[model samples]
Target chain A: MLDSESPTKSPMKTGESATRATTRDRLAAASLWLPVVILSVTATLWSRRLPAELPVEWLGNEGGAFRSTAVFSGITGTFALFAAVAGIIALAGVAATIRPWLVLVAGMVGGSATAAWLVAAGFGLAGEPMPASAVPWMVALVLAAASYGVVPYLLSSRQRRVRLGDAAAGVPLGVGEAGAWFTTIRVRVFGVFAAVSTLAAAVIAVLLVPRDAVGASAAIVALLLVAAGFLVFSRLRVSVDHRGLRVVSSLFRFPIAHVELNRIVSARSAELRAAEWGGWGYRVMPGRTAIVVSGRRGILVERDNGTHFAVTVPNPDLPVALLTTLVSR
Target chain B: MLYKVDPASAVTIADQLAVQVRVAVADGSLAPGTRLPPARELANALSINMHTVLRAYAQLRDDGILEMRQGRGASVRADAAAGTVRLVELADALLAEARKLGVGIPDVLILIQKRGTHA
Candidate 1:
C-alpha cells in the first residue's frame, strides 16, 4: 500500500497544492514548457538543415569514437511515431480523469520533449557523431530536464478550487484554553524499499560492480535516484493549533501547506480511501487535494481559499477537536 | 498523538509534552520504536525553546517512556505502552480528585512518594 512510485503512476496523482486552473498558471506552464518547445522546434529545424544522414558515433571501440552515418529522419520518424502512440494512450487514459489539463500536458510533453532534446542537444551541433564521451553529458541533460519538469509540476500543484461542502463547526473552546496537535507518519513499505535499493546500489558500487567507467557511473546514477526516492518516500509531520494547520513533509522540508486560522473555514474527520486520491503521496484533483498515507482516517481542512487539504494520520480525534475548538473561537 | 503545550495553561510546557507521550503510547498513536522529531525541530514547530523540548524528552527518558540516542533523536520505548496507559489514566483521575480536594501538586507528589515507599 505504501508503494506510490510505480512505472505507471495514476494520472490522477498530482501536486499537493491544487490551485484552481487559471491563466496565470497556464502562463507559468508555458514559460516552463518554453525550453522544451524550443528544443522540439529547433531539433526539427536542424533535421531539415542537415544533409540526408546524421553522423552517428560508436564509442565501444577501445581507442576513439568510430564515425558511422545513420538517417536522422529515421530517429525523428521513430520519435514522431512514439509521440503519436503515447499521445493517444495519454489522451485516452489521463486527459479524461486528470484535473487542470496542464498536468496532462506536462506528462505528455515533458516526456517526449526530454527524449527529443536528449538527442538534439547532443548531436545536433556536434556534426561529428557522438562518442562514449558525449554519453555523460546526455545523461546530465536528461536529469536536468527531469528536475525542470518537477518545478512546473510543483508550481501547478499550488492552488485549486475544492467543492465547499456543508460547513461543520469546530469544537468549542473554553476561555484560556489553548492546545496543539502533532503527529509524524513515516512510510514503512516504501522506506524499506528505498533503503534496500540504496543499499544494493552502494553494495554494487563498492563490492561487486567493476570499477569501469560505465559500471561505476551507472551505479552512481542509481544511487542518486535512490537518494531522491528516500526523500520523496520519507516521513511527514503534522500539527494543528492556534497557528492553524501545518504539514511538513520530509521531502527536502517541503512544506505541503501552512493554512492559517483566519483562512480556514472548517475542518472534519473523514475516511480517505485511496481510490478517491488516485494513489498515495500527495494527490490533487479538481475538488480535493490529499497527502495520503497509512491508517486512512484523517482530518480534512477547508481553507478560506476554497481549497481543501486532507492528510492521513493514525489518530484524528484530538486534532479534529483542536482545530474545531480553535476555529470556533 | 497530538503534542500540545499551552503557555497560558497551569501545566508547564515540559510536563505537557511528556504527558502527551504517555497518552500517545497508551492510545497506540505512537507505537514502539517510533522516532520522535528532534527537540530542535519540534521546538521550531511549536514556537518554543529547544531546551524546553529537551527537558520534556529527558523527563520521558528518565521515566522509561522514551529512549534517546545521540543522533537518532527519541523514540517510544517498546515496553512503555500498556503500563503507561494505566499510569496516565490513574494520574488523570488523581489530578481530577486532587483538584476536587483542593490538594496542591507538591502534596500529591509527597503522597505518591509515601505510597511508593510502602509498596
Candidate 2:
C-alpha cells in the first residue's frame, strides 16, 4: 500500500546518466567459472599420482594418515563434488542477491586445503604421525573468512559513487520549526533463531554440568550465548531529522546506513514482505538495497542518482513524512 | 502512533505529546494496556528534553490514561475510560475549528456554554 507518495514524474530524467553495474564487475564475477574447469582437469591428473586407497578422514587425532582408507576414485570424486558445488553457487549468483564469486572462493578454499591432506597421504606421507596437515586447513579458513569481505570490495560493483538528486519534499516546517521521528524495529526472524540457538546451548550445559570441569562447560555455554547474540543480527534504531535518515544498531549504536536528505528523490511508506526483497538483514540487488527486519511497515527511498534504498521500520509514516519534508527543502 | 512536535507551535511539548497519546487512544491504535516507549527513548529520538517527556507522562497519569511504576515504565491503564478520550478528541476538533476561524478558547467556551445549556 502506498501512502503519502510523491507525484509521478517522467520515467527518466532528461539529463540523467543511467547508473548500473559495470561490465568489469560481471566479468570478474563470472570469471570464477574458469577455476572449476581448471580444477576438474587438475584433480583428474592428481589422482594418477595417488595410491589405490585414501584416508577416510583428513583431520583425525594424528591427522588423516591415522584414519581408515578409501578407494582412490572415492577421494577424487569427493574433491570434484566440492568443486561442482562451488560452480553451482557461481552460476546461481547472477540471479540472486548472494554474490557468486565470494561463495565459490570459500568452497574452493575449503576443498583445496582438504585435498592437500589427501594428496599428502597418497604420496608416502601416509603414516608416522602427519599432524602438520591441520595447518593448511586453518590457514585456508582464515583466508576464506578474509575473502568474504576482501573479494567483494576488490571485484564487485556493490558500492557505486552516488551524486545528489533533486529531492522531493511535501510536509512543511515553519520558520525556526524542526521535526524528528524515531522507531526501533526488532527483527523477529533473527530473534527467534537466536533464542532457539541459545536454548539448545542451555540444554547442552544442563546435561554436561553434572560432569567435572565446570570451567570448560561454562566456557562452552558462554561461547554459545555470544554466538546467539550475534545471530540476533541487530535491533535497528531508525531516525529521520534535519540530518536525513539514519539507521543504527541498538547494541553498538553504530551507524548501519544513512541517506543524506540531498540525495533523496522521494520517499513513501510501503507494506513490504521481507522474503520478496531477498530475506531479512541487509540485501543488495542491482541498483537497490533493502534493510528488512520483522517486515511490514517499510520506507522506500528513491535516490537522485537512480538508486533506491528501502528500510523496514515499526512505524514508517513519521519517517516518511519527515524525510519527504526534508528532501523537499 | 504518530508522534510529532513543533517547537514553534503555541502548544507546550508535553501537551503535544499527551494529546497525541489521547488521539491515539481515541482512534484505538494505542489499545488499552499497550506500553508506550520509555520517556528517555522517546526524548532521545525527538532530540527533546527527557523531562519534557516525563511531564507528558505525568499529565497522562493524572488524566487516568496511563499507569507508571518505578521500574516497569508506563502503559495505558486497562480501565482508562473511553469517555475521556472521546472528550479529548472532541475538544481537539473544536479547538482546531476555532483556531481556523480566528477565534480563541474563551470564545469557543462561551459558544459551548450557550449550546451545551440549550441541549
Candidate 3:
C-alpha cells in the first residue's frame, strides 16, 4: 500500500528569485525550434517556386514595386514582432497540456512569412531556378515544425503503474544516471530514428522532387505526408525507460528531468487537495516552477526550477531516487 | 529556546530527532501509544526537511521506540520504557564525564537538572 504522509517539503519555494532563470531557459529551448521551422518553410516555398509551369511575371522598375517590397517586408515584420511576443507568452505556458500551440503559431507565421519573402525578393528578381542549398534548409524547417508537434505527444506517456517486465533489468546504477541514460537501447533507438527521419526528409526534398510539375503539387504533398509520417512514427515510439529513468522519444535522449538525491532538499509523495500546487506539467508548488508534474498521486522535489526534472515514468519514486543520486553526486 | 545545531555536525537529522523523542519517552512526558506529530508538522516546527523526521521515525521504529501506521500517524511504542533505560544510562555517563572533568558536582547536577526540564 502507498504511504499517505505529506512526504518532505523542499526548502526551495516558488518565489521572485527564479523568474530570471525560468525566462532564460525558456528562451533557449524555444529558440532551437525557430531556426528549424524557418529552414523547412523556406524549403517548401522554394519547392513551389521551383516548378517550371507556374506563370512568372516581372513587376516593372517604373513603378515603386521596390516600395511594395518594403511594405511587404514591414507587414511581415509586424507579424514576426507579434509572434516573438506570443512566443514569450507560450513559454510561460510550458506546463500546460496544449502549450505547444504557442510554438505552432509562432513557427507557422514566422516560417510562411520568411518563405514568401525569400521567393519574392531573391528568386523572383533573379528569375533563376531555386538554389540547390535552399532545398535542404526548407526540408529542415518542415521537419523541425513537425518535430515540435511530435515532442509533447511522446513526452506525455501513459501514466499507469509500471509493469513487472518494464523495469530496468540489470543495468547498473554505477554508470551513474547519465551513463544509465546513454546505455538504454530504447533511448538510443529513438535518437537514431529522429536522425534518420531528418536525413530522409532532406534527401527527398533535394533529390526526389523534380524541378518541374509533371505532378509537382502531388509530389510536394507526398513529401509533406512522408515528413508527417516520420513525425508521428517518432512520437508513437517515445517511452520512458523507468529503470533507466531517462526521457526516450524519437530524436530526444537528453535528461530533461531527474532529482539529484543530495541536491533534493525534500521528497514528497502526496495526493494534492486543490490545485494547491497548480495544474500539471512543470509548475511551482509553493516554490520554484523548475520541474513540477501534477498526476493522480506523484512525487514532488524541492529544488530550483532547473534543478528538479519531471517525466511520466512508472514507479515515480525510482526516477526520484535516480534523480537524487544524480544531484547528490 | 534557541539551541543552534552545528551546520557541520556529523549528526544526521534522524539522530537529532531520536534524541528528542527518546528524551520525551524517558521522562514519561509522551506516554506509550501517544501519537507524535506527523513528519510534515514536526519538520515545519523544527524548520527542517520532512525526510529528516521520517528518517528519525524509521530509525526509532527499527529501534523499537516508535510505531507508525498508515493514516493513523506515528506513536510511542509500548517498548519505549526499555528505550528509556538506554537514555537514562547515557545521561548518567555524560554526567559522570562532567564530574571527571573537574566540574563541581553541584554544577553537573544543575546542568542535568536544567536539561531534564527541557526534556
Candidate 4:
C-alpha cells in the first residue's frame, strides 16, 4: 500500500525543467514535418534515378502468376502512400481535438504500411525480386508501434495504487465514524455490444479466411480486438475510505485513480457532458483527465499537484463529502 | 473527509449532515474560507431531497459558521472558529438545562427571547 502522506507535489528543478522543455520543443518540431521532409527527399532522389516504366509481378494463391508493365515507376505509388501517412501524422499532432489513441492507432497502421511499401520499392529499385510475402514484416512493425504507444499508458496508470486489503481493513463501523462506501457501475449496454460485435467479427474472420498464414494473421487481429473491447467496456468500481478515494475496474481490478486523502486539495460535484469531454471513456486533455461513463453528474477532484480529474457517476456527493472530511482530518 | 447519513437513524438526514459539517469545522478539518460542496450534488449522492441539503446549509449559514453567496456557493467564515466553539458550548449547556428542567425546545426559545428583550 502507498503511504497516504507521501509527497504529491512534483516541482521540477530549474535544470530539469529546462531540459524537459528543450526535449518537448524538439519533439514538437519533429512531429510537425520530419516524416514529410524525409519522404519528400527520398521521393525526389528516387524519381530521378528510376525508369518511367517498370515490370510488376503478381503471384496468385492458386499457382498462377502474371506480369504487367506500369506506366509510372513503382516508387511513385510507394512515395504517395508515405506522403499521405506523414501528412496525417502532422495534422493529428497539430489538431487539439484528435485523441492520443487515434493518433497512436493511425501511427501504428500508417507507419507499418509505409515501411512495408518502402521496403518493397527498395527491392524493386535494386533489381532484386520482391519477397513473396510482406505480411509478417508489416505485422511485426505494427505490433512494435502499438506496444510503443500502449506500454507507457499502462505503466503510468499502474502507478496509482489500489490496496483492496488495506482499504477493506480501514472501514470498521463505530459510533460517529464513517465506514467505507463501495459501489460498482457496470456499463452493461456498451460492454455487451462491444463484446458481441468483436466476437462475431472474430468468428466471421476465422470462417471466411483461407487456412493460410494471412488467414491466421487476420484471426489473431480479430481476437485482439475482442480482448480490447472487453477491457474497454468493463465495470467501474469506486471505493472511499480513510485512506482516500479508489476507482478500479471490476473485471481486472486495475487502478484508475487512487487519490490519497492528503493529496486531495478539494472535491466537488460537477455536471459532465460527453460533448464537452469529446465523447470519452478516458479523456486526456490539456490540463485535465477524465473518466466518463453515462451520467452527467460527476465528481471533480483537484490534487495538490494542481492536476484535475473528473469521474462521471450517478452519485458524486458522498465521495465529495468523504474526501472533504478526510482532507479536513 | 468522511460524512455519513443513516436514513434509518432517529436523527433527520439534514441534521446529520449539519452535525458532520459543524464537527468538521470545530475540529479544524474544514479551514476558514474553505468552500463546501453544492447542495444539489450532495443531495444526489446521499439519495436525499435537495431541500434537505439546502436546509442544512441554511442552518450553518444562520449560525455564522458558513457564508453563502449568490454564485460562489458556501464557505466557512473567516472567524468561524471562535464562533463555532462558542456555539457548541452554548448548545451543550442549553440542551443539558432543557433536559434537566423537562422543558421543550420551543419553551426554551421563548424564555431566551423574553429574557433578551428585558435585558
Q: Kindly list the per-residue Cα lDDT of model 1 for residues A118-163, writing each as its tens digit.
A: 4644574566566777666655554455444444445443443332
Q: Per-residue alpha-carbon lDDT of model 4 for A246-303, expressed as tens digits? A: 7777556477877777887776666666655657588776556778887866667778
For A1-329, candidate 2 gives per-residue lDDT tens digits of: 11223332212122122223455445545443443454456556665554544443333334443343333334444554554455344334232334433444545553454454445444333434324665566445534533433342355455432222333334555655556665566566676676776776777677766676557576667768765555545566677776677787765557788988788878876555554456667878667778877656577788899887888876565567668877777
| DockQ leaderboard ranking | 2, 1, 4, 3
- The most accurate candidate by DockQ is 2
Relative to the true structure, candidate 1 reaches a TM of 0.54
Q: iRMS for all predictions?
A: 8.5, 5.2, 18.7, 9.3
- In model 1, pairs of residues that clash are A17-A157, A18-A159, A18-A160, A19-A159, A19-A160, A20-A159, A20-A160, A170-A324, A171-A324, A182-B2
Candidate 3 residue-wise lDDT, A26-119, digit = tens: 5533653454455445545655444332111322123343435445555555655565565555444222322344445565665555544554
Clash counts per candidate, in order, are 10, 1, 19, 4
- Could you give candidate 4's per-residue lDDT for residues B1-119 as a string of tens digits? 34567777898888888877787777776678866655654564456788998999998888888999997678789999956657765976897889898999889889989998999
Model 3 ranges off by over 4 Å: A1-17, A20-82, A91-112, A127-298, A302-306, A311-329, B1-119
Over 4 Å off, model 1: A1-168, A203-219, A249-257, A260-262, A270-278, A284-289, B6-10, B27-29, B41-49, B84-119
At residue B66, what lDDT does model 4 achieve? Answer: 90
| Cα error of candidate 3 at position B99, Å | 51
Worst 10-residue lDDT window, candidate 4 chain B = B37-46
Worst window of 10 by summed lDDT in candidate 4 chain A: A160-169
Q: What's candidate 4's DockQ score?
A: 0.06
